[model samples]
Target chain A: MTDPARAALAITHEPEGGLVLVLRGELDLAGLPGLAPALDDVFALPRQPVVLALDDLTFLDSTGVSLLIRIANHFGTVRTRGAAEPVRRVLEVLGLAGRFGLGEG
Target chain B: MVTSAPRRLSILVGVVLLLITAALSFLAWLAHAESEENLLRRQLAQVGTLLGSQATVLQVQLADIGQVAVATDGNPSAFAAFADRQLTETGQSLSLWRVDGDDMEQVALQGVPPLLPDGGADRLTELEPDGRLVMFGILPGEPRRLAYGLMPGEDNTDFVVYGEAPLAPNGRVEPAEGSPLAGLDLGLYLGEDAAPEQLLQATAPVPIEGRTETTSVPFGNSTLTIVGASQGPLTGIQSAALPWVVLGVGGLLALGGAATFEFVSRRRAEAERLAAENDRLYRQQRGIAGTLQHALLPAVPELPGLEVAARYVAGEDELQVGGDWFDVIGRGPGSCVFVVGDISGRGLPAATTMAALRFAVRAYLAEGHTIEDVLARLRGLLDIETDHQFATVLLGDLDVPAGRLRLVSAGHFPPALLADGEVMLVDCPVGTPVGVSPSVADSAVTVPVTSAATMLAFTDGAVERRGETIDTGLDRLRTAAGGVVSRPLDGMLDDLLGALVSPGNKDDTVLLGVRWG
Candidate 1:
């Protein structure tokens, strides 16, 4: 278990014409507000393939998954890289692994 | 906790303050009394000094005249001139007397003629040799007088310098305005005792009275007794009223302190009473919520050839009951339609919404609609915007003898299937939670199981927790169900609940289980 308020994020430009957003720490209801400004920065970009880096992520809930679904519906092509086993399991059980291109539960 | 506790505390504070005020006032009064006595004593001493000073002035004047009498060898012209200066007041006299054996003669006189009778001259002859100075009271007459005689101190001096002065008007010697004894009622008397006839001078009439003090000062061959009393307080007005001031101010402070103490104490008691009342009301509302929650729940159906048991746990937090329920309807022999749904929020609104949806499910299922249709129909029952709530449900049409289950999920978790001592969480296609929009469940996922398989469907309360993943909880449930799968359905469900429900879980949990019998 982790506190979502201390959640951290980093942005990197990719040479393949996309933006990579890295997220760390527990992402929960209490931690969502801290990411708003950063999310706004991403929202300003036009139709770029967004890559999510979730290797260091420790926790995920239905609300957090709903947000990921919104991101998938927003971008041209959204891809998740190095997702942890627990995060993949929730996405798989909610039948969204195919949508986000995360293989297996 | 006693009803009178605050009142008793106030009384205690008041008594303490009153005692303190009394003690302070008493001390101030004591100081006042002591200084008053000293003041009276000091005034009486001044009166004695006044009388003695007058006597000294007379002796000094007479002694000078005696020197003149000896130097002039009893010359009348020189004596008259010097003696006239000594008679500074009206009705006064000075005389030169020659004393011989058993006789006396007035050689010279000045000012008023002597008012003494024949015995007065004889009394001067009685003055012995070496007499310093002598003063005697003359017998009572109009405007009484005192006579003084001084034989010259030198040897062989037969001439005596004598003087007489009548008392002032009414025998009252009014002290000068700024004198130390100005504000005093005073009396001076010859000799120690204050005899009426012996009164020499007085400010007050006749006898001095009212808080009087007496003292004595040396006079020629005798003493003058001085009696005095103060006309007003010796100390200033503030000091005179000091004791009353202390009492008045201290009394006010005492009452203020007591009143403040009573007010605070009563407030604390009132606050405590309100807190207890809130606690009682909270418990009462929780009790009512529990009763209402149970009354709205549907009893599990008794289907032939199937063993079923369901459990519901109310959350221990908030006064309102959570909205989570499970229902099982028997369709035919060894067949049943079971539905498990969870509302997103709580209280009467969530509970009413849950009730409406649960009833709708029962109605549609009785109409021989498929499990997918039951889930799709719920979308029309509620809208998240109007009701401020959403619901997720797991609906299943189970074939107990056939060991087959058809499941449809609306944003709900798949049920766990246990058979031959193996546990598996079914992978039903998840859809949007009901109430988000008017949508249809277009897919129904069917999974086959062993004849002895038992299935358990539950709400998210069984697995979801903050700061962790839901899969961790799902794993725990699977492990627990594998261990208890061989037991009777009711006993197995109890074991699973005890093992999987964490002590920190405050969310409501609903566990619906069905086993092939």
Candidate 2:
């Protein structure tokens, strides 16, 4: 039960000096609150494209999709990749698939 | 509500039954004790009357013998012959005595002589006129005797006859065998008063605690007191044990009844506890399902120069969450796709399937695929994932700048077009629902779009009811949509749902509407 709510967010430096924020586990209303610090950390880095990797994400909800939209708005160049089927489905349902760059695009 | 009422009534009845049993047992025990006491009193009274009469008869016989001896004028030979004849007839021992001054002289002895103390003979002379008999040597360890005096001559010469007899035939004063008082103790006293010290003959040990009765009998001139005490306030062993038996049996029955009641109550309590626990777990599972359903749906985004409104209503039954979803995807500048679909079944599986399909369509469209291409690709994706599920979907690509709409249907309800105050279902090529077949031959139809046109797409839940046909539901939707086609997109969607969905609808409904401005 706790595993779904303990979704972790990690920031790593890419070889091209871009930042990649990896979101793992469930990203629903329960786990959305923990993403604030990770967002703040990514925004503090030098202005560059930040890759939001959602490949390891097991779940996502409406609230999590809105959170991603806010993160995309904050970064000048935000590209999303590696979203699992469930997470990708939420982004597509909201018509944010093109904006988030999810699913074979 | 009906089931619980009978359970409470049965418990009330059980309590009433237990109370009634206890009351009856107490009443029965009380009646038994009362009857036993009365029986003991009656037996004691009867024994006292019988023993008193026996003592009186013995005293009378002795007094008559004294009169016979006095008639003989103190002659020893004649008195001896007469006393011997009377003693032999009565089966008692007797002696004749002459009273002189204060001494008693033995005139003749027929059998065992009566043991007299020094003043015993003088006391007998004082009883000449009153004819009272004087008893002597009747205490324990003394010979039992009865004496009475008579004055035969006018000159007042005193003659006395004394007899010695066994108080009881075999030194025991019990009632005769087979008598009702056989189980009692009888004490015979030779005086008016029936005191413990005056006890003369006793049948059995006098009980300190029991029912007793005393009767006085006239013996010659003196009264004999017969005191009878019942063995233990009851006639026999059976009678004595009756009250205790009643109480014991009654107590046992009451205990048994109480134990059964307690056992039933405990079982009922255990059943109630288990039912409450089951209800709690059910609610918990429902909560998780609700969370998963809400997480899969997101709000429709606001777009420039277009009115996009969508509504998602869960089933009336809170525990059931299904896979009905609608999406408005932005493809490029002034172009977006509106999708409405219903997945088969319910709960997390349907919800996850709906989510995957919605994303897959958006991904395909983003890569410049038409509605028909997107549906084909979604079917292949589901087939590869081994998801044995199917969905009905309607997809429409709207170009706001060019006012052109491309529509396609995949085993889904046709989208309703409201224009010029008239509502009509769009004519499009329909194919099998996605994921049911390996491939499909379906195409999208391009229709001229106008600013006055409003398009509504919804799942079957919005119009379907039990025992009703799909055509009837479609007609109702068309009529409701015509009334609200001129309103804003949000108001139009609400009015359409209000006319189509009722509180009794058990399936999830999703309505997505777009108005070209």
Candidate 3:
């Protein structure tokens, strides 16, 4: 439903013992072509305890904030936290302040 | 200091003294004039009485002259010898003229001399009709004469005695033995001049008053002419001691004005210096803010298959930088880790912590560690790196292909999930913020992933402040994010950021959202 050309998703590991995956550039209606498929791949991961660290993300609109929320709800027992300031604020504003924590080892 | 004060005070005193001196000098001049006037008046009074006494003495001498002349019956020689003897003893001028039937012959040459050499005898004969004696002579500058009338003679012959006197240079009538004006410097005019005495009185030609008495003022001519002067009394006194008062007052005012001016100038300068320093400090703070802000924020990263965006805003207050960070790292195909956290405090120190935490998160994610293991590692890293710098974070693992998300909370707020046009807060148990505890409980949450569903993650700075309940701010956040309930993940993230972050507060905010469409 969204354009894939502008959508992108990537991940890295934090030295503090967690995985930091960054969504760069835009995740919007014009970018859904690439964004939705990336979300599908993330849901396919087989890891039991994964920590997503969005420390270097540059932009996240409401669509992006909801995507993280869905992932958080999907992994209710996995324990989610955001390392970046902008990502944390969006989550907290959505009344999901308790689900996020520091990413450290 | 005391010496300088006194010196300044003395200068003030000197100025006052100078003013006083001038005032006293003027007053003294006036007093001197008044004193002189008084002295003149006293001298005039004394002179008036002295002239009266002199006129009486002359009358006594003249009476004797007439008595001798009449008793001898034209015995000019006998009268002449007697007049000479009287004149020598009294140090005055006396003349005896025998009027032998209009042939008036002067027979005595005593202290009196012939009138100037111009009509000496003729001037004596040119007397008034009732004149006892009238003549003129020069002893000082003006000639004076004494007149006498024949005392009730039984014989048909009249013999009169006349005298003239010389006035001193100072206009004093020579004082007789008993005169109050004796030895005083004053002028006395007793005889009538060319002008009639009555005319002089009516005209009030001079300043003195005329006194008239019937008592015989014995002139040497056995007659008296009333005497007075042409001036009033004078009084004055002189002293020198009053200018000091004016000088003293003037000096005090000058010193006071100078000292006050100096004090005001110094205080104004001090205030100006302080204001300048304050301005300088403000500018330096601004520079620090600009540099610190740019330093902590991440440069946008490039990824694929997902529209990802992030923005970090620094805190506005100069105290420090608010610690909010975001990170995204790729794991395997269709899998990524998203993390956001808030470090405590603001400004430089918080910025420092933010950098350390950001790198730590990157390191842990690269190591391919689990969420709980990552949090513990991050906590240990912070304890080592910052001597226990505390922070709250939320880390997530996105399984995009499977449409699932696994998240771990480290004392951070929960994330939001927008599924099927409905907004839900994905509740997860919070662990202590990293660096506070040595380790975290091994607990995590799993949320059902749906296609096109958006997940929102953030730090507490997005919803926390003084006088505000965290719950209230969270409610506002949910409401704002819920408006774009069905947006594509990236668009929804933008809408949420715009709704929640207030630009007025400069605190750092980090937000990351992902969706499976």
Candidate 4:
């Protein structure tokens, strides 16, 4: 029953001292409650530059897009890695590709 | 009305629960009564066993007396000594008799004088076999005497010994202190029937009453009937109260269940009513909003050498007054200004913002503001952060005499142009949607219009689908418009909408069309 709202997350510190957060499964309103603590911990990390891995993310909605926007707006040095085409397109249409360092979507 | 249904349901449930409680209570009571009856029978059985043993003891004593009579050759002194230890009460007797056929004569008498009549059959020896112990039956006295006789050895039928025991006056005997039969009302009758005259002793009156247990115990050759009834509950107070307790608790539980059912049903009905009321109100609001939006829009003005047509369709699932509107103003002979705009959200706030933007645009154009300046001025009417809304608009000026057209866009879909029977999307730069950012970089582009060319501009609702690229929707719109552009302007616009608008669209849409010669 909780599987739909279930999110599996992994955080790894890169050799170059950057933190990469991997997101998997659905990312929607229902998953937000369980994800809030993880997000808070990420915001507290000393690392200024953060990389997001969205290759495993199966779904994203407006709320998920809002969270991404908040993350990009927070850390100017943040960049997304392996964002899906649909994910990139949403950011592109909102004209936030430059903010997330995904040029021309 | 809601109360009526819950009340009816509760009544039905209550009746069913009450019936179940009654049935359970009755069964428990029956079982308790059965156990009580069994206990009474057991008590009577115990009394019968004790009395039967007493009868055996009497026979033994009488046989001993008979032996003494034989040893002493019927000496009266020997008989008196044995009889002295055998008599139990003041109104009792013991004697030794010589049985000659059916006539028995007493050899000695001890205690009270024997009640046997002279010259009468001993009755004890008449029916009983030679040496068997037998009942002599009751004798009349202040207190009745119960007599028994035993001849002893079968070889000797001549000598017989008889004994008698007294009963209480009025057939009532006070139970001994601490007697086990203390809790019972008991009656001991001489025979199977508890006849008043045959009752030898009793704790209560002549006959025990109410659910009595009757048991028979052997007394010499006859049987004594012991009839008994419990003075109170045989198994104590808790057992007596158990059935009532079950009934009480069952009744409470049945009531509780019915009340809970009523509460839940009432709550559900209330929720349903509230939901229906909300729906009715929502539809009413939508109707007013639709009417208001139509009133705010201008009637299409006819222009010389030009054809104009437009449509406004509210999405099936869209809020009543979402921001979608179109305007066409006749500027003079062979020229007109057209506008198509869409606001981002829904409801009264979005509708109000849309109205403000529309009137502002009309004022700007009426003041002779250039199409580019007019599109730019629309930005000042709203701020997305404050209103949480933005408008995507397209404006065009068409001149049929010069076959020229000018177009400007504010983050809106590019207008479709059909010229020489070829369909193409206008190459126009889209500015940031108005009210989104403080300042936007934009301009107007003029393109020469071919003779009798038709141009269509519309909102994203005409092509927008969730999770899909807007370009695919645009391509679809372009193809659809191309197929129907050959028809008259009104038919063309209607067909395009029929082809492009899907029922699942949740945003209102507006389409503006202009045909120039």
Candidate 5:
């Protein structure tokens, strides 16, 4: 059986110099390997706005939130949208929603 | 109790099994040894029987030669022809002697020398009527021989006939080549005496050790003793070694099995010890968490014309101290601010966050802030302090004398109202959980509280389970609260909690009841 805690990352480059990364499934310690390469690819791109779409994410642990914060720091114009309730809760609790431009319509 | 009874029983069984295995091996070995000894004895007896029969055959042949000599009747030519014929017919040598005035002359001889020496003839002359003498002796150039001499009837004038046959080295009548007793040491003694002097022939000169079997054969005037000795004990290679091998292997297998059992049991005992230690630590931490939760929760205040009661029950999982909590602060003489909130996580971190939010709400209320203003400020507090911790809270301002209640829900379960024997949940506008966003606005709903009406507020733990929907738990809470609204506030809470809370509920629960009188 596949591990429920592992996540899958899909990154798409928009024509407007923006990258949309969609994170699906649980983003726990088991998911870190799949996330690391995608994150590295996002960092390697030329300076552009990155949008993290977390609508499909089922769960997010503290380590995953730390990684998201790191991603935001890498690309200064990063915005997060479509966060599930749990992800939104964590972002709000850590006070990162406003800093990362999360929950914007 | 700490000493395992099963382990003790297993050890006892192992020891018993080992002893049984050892005993069975020894018995098997013993049986094989006994059978081997019996085989040896039987072999010795067989050799003895064979030797006895060979001696009988030799004696009979000698007697026949003696009878032939008697028939010759002292005639020199007749005796010569008779002796030569006997020598050729039997495989023995023969001689004829004539007795005359204390002297014996060998008148006829064929294939053998005279039975007596020239000077020893006087001894034979003394022979009485039909007298016989059997002797075993070696000729000068021949192998060992058995000779028999017989005198014909009482007249001293008749001749004596002597017949002699060659014997094997061991004195056996048969040749050693085809003899069953070939490989064994044997001795033949004449005249029933087995002493060294009487031994006529022997294969080996050494005295036989251990046991020997003897058979006796009666010759004409002497008894022949056939003594047979085995080469060694009758035990084959497989028979001798099989018993020892079984015993050794059985012992090793028993030891290995017992050792394996001991190793497994020791590991089980160690695992049990670790589990027990972990359980003890979990309970201790649960106790500390419970204490912290109780210390941080405020007691229901005594507001006039209102009966206020609140209960906080920790979750069944002793290690998981959850974040469910409640607080009641008297806002003014006839008004009170009551709050019930649940943090999203468990253990110390959740408990800490619950305490922070609870106290912050009280501080904001004491400063005369509205319910929405207090929630807004709580959001700010959670956002600044906690990294991944959030709470859902239902805050209310109860004005008892005016019979009015104002409620603000921040992603929390709405309170249920029981009035006029009807129970219904108070649906209010829900903002995102306090930590989600600082800009999210919270709106309030004001409802009228009739006389003898009850308001029930609780965390989701009071309703939610592993697989069931949240609505099912809410419906159950409504049914329970509606049925017990007429009872005293404390008893009502007891009944409601008993009906709403399930066994093995993994989350903490906080229930608050405000009965307007």
Candidate 6:
């Protein structure tokens, strides 16, 4: 595994067996350049249920929001399931969490 | 890249070229004139040499005593002997002669006619007497058209010969073979009526200097006159070369001038285009900032029975558009809901967070949530909805009939109290900025509408900044709110915003004011 400073993804698995991603800065047109690789890792994992937490995220713009929606839409519940409360809220605000079946179910 | 240097260099080069061309043209013209002068001078020298040779021949023949006496006394035998000797020695053509005596009588010797023609006797009698012989007549019956005359010498009693020689080619005489003037026109003339100045003036001036030479040679017994004039007009060859040189140089100069003009004009056009583009980009950046600020704020919500007024001011600096917002919701029965919030940070992200907070407050209020419950729910909603972006807000419900105001403060500034021509700050407990935590603790404060006249709620940016602390802003806000408390609430809001929030406020400032009788 390669470690790059502020490399687009910084994920730490919590003691409760959930993944917590700390997105400290902003996600704008500039930040979109390296986000694809991190998101790919999330979708390529096994079908086991996992909580994708975005609690440490300080800023998320429309570009970031759109990427989240596209991930959930493309990978329906059969392959990917469960997400943290904050991430679910962002998806609901964008009106896509229900379609992906990732909230409360 | 400095255009002026190249431009000046080009201009300097052009001036130098102009001066050089002028000097060259003047020199060329001088050379042309000099060439013509050389041609004329060579011709004159040749003519002078020929005249010298002719005079020597005549002088030798005249020195012969036999030939002179025979020609003067009209002796055929002596003339025949002299003519035979001259033919054998000099190979010259023997010509006409006239003799004058001391008695002013003249005689024609051999080589003259045997019988006089109609006007021949008068012509022969016209010679001068006293041994100063004079002769002048036109020869006839020959293609050469030669004329000859002889006058006697002053003291020696000898005669003089005057003559017009035949033209070699056309009317001009030709120089001898291998002469410097062999191909030139040597039109020499000598007489009292001939003007030397007129001939000299006909030729163009040239720079050559050798003084005129004079030599006297014998002709019969009198001296033959010889004068050389070196002058002639410029030939076609010299005069024709100027126009062609001028045309060629002038065409080159015109082409260079036109190209330089076009290059300068094109650069000027490019400069104008760059300036216009810069102006357009500046304007577009300004518009983008303004749109972001507008998007974050709430549209003014209409509330019944309560005179609610709000004003928002955006900073003037280009990079400083921010997130400050206010909203009023009508809660039915002469009561209404009001809020003023400030999102953390500046620019677009702050604006987005403010938008979420504002809508969340309005939605909770519409669902019949109490003022305190609405604040709690809004805190929870933002904690979940936003990443870490937070908003500081004050939410209140006004009961117009009950004459009471209930409010929940989430780390927001306390409201300003206006009463009896004085302004005071209403004391309230502060809470943490909303969305900082999932469970934010908030404090509810209630103030009676009795004798309070007007209440003003505002974001920190309305009366605060980096220089002035929160207390100083509160004091300034209180003073401003005192003057307008007696007037209508909407006008008072305008006056307060006009006084404290804008034209100079360096951040987005949101203000909401309400009054109840």
Clash statistics: count for each candidate = 0, 1, 239, 0, 0, 7
Off by over 4 Å in 4: A1-105, B1-31, B117-119, B122-130, B247-309, B315-321, B332-335, B436-442, B487-491, B515-517
Flag the better candidate by TM-score, 2 or 3: 2
Clashing pairs in 4: none
* Per-residue lDDT value at A2 in model 2: 28
CAPRI docking class of candidate 4: incorrect
Scored against the native two-chain complex, candidate 5 gets a DockQ of 0.07
Q: Looking at model 5 chain B, which ten-residue stretch has the lowest summed lDDT? A: B133-142
Shift in Å, residue A32, candidate 3: 50
iRMSD, all candidates: 4.1, 15.5, 12.9, 4.3, 7.2, 14.1
lDDT per residue for candidate 5 within B1-517, as digits (tens), equals 5447547755776777678777877887787778765765576567656655655564454445555555655556666665565464444677777776677777677775544433355655655445445453433334545555666554433666666766555443332686765666667677675876556667655354445666676645566666666565456667667777777777777777766777787788788989999898888777787788888888677877667898888878447688888988876656788888987666777778888898898788879899999988898877513456667788998886787889987768778988898998987766666665533467888988776678899986787654444566777888888789789889999988889888877667889988776
Q: Which stretches of candidate 6 lie over 4 Å from their true place?
A: A1-105, B1-153, B156-158, B172-302, B317-321, B343-353, B370-390, B400-404, B408-412, B429-440, B459-461, B464-474, B501-506
lDDT of 2 at B399: 90
* lDDT tens digits by residue: candidate 1, B435-469: 55422344888898777778999987788665566
Q: What range of 10 consecutive residues in model 1 chain B has the weakest lDDT sum?
A: B433-442
- Give all TM-scores, in the order shown: 0.69, 0.63, 0.48, 0.77, 0.66, 0.54
- lDDT, candidates in the order shown: 0.78, 0.67, 0.57, 0.76, 0.70, 0.55
Residue-level lDDT tens digits of model 5 in A2-99: 36447878888668756888889877545766677676777687666789888898767544664675566556677888876556755653435565
Candidate number of the best TM-score:
4
Interface root-mean-square deviation, candidate 5: 7.2
User: Looking at the true structure's interface, with contacts defined as alpha carbon pairs within 8 Å between chains A and B, what fraction does model 5 recover?
Assistant: 0.00
By DockQ, the candidates rank as: 1, 4, 5, 6, 3, 2
Model 6 sits at an interface RMSD, in angstroms, of: 14.1
Error of 2 at B31 (Å): 5.2
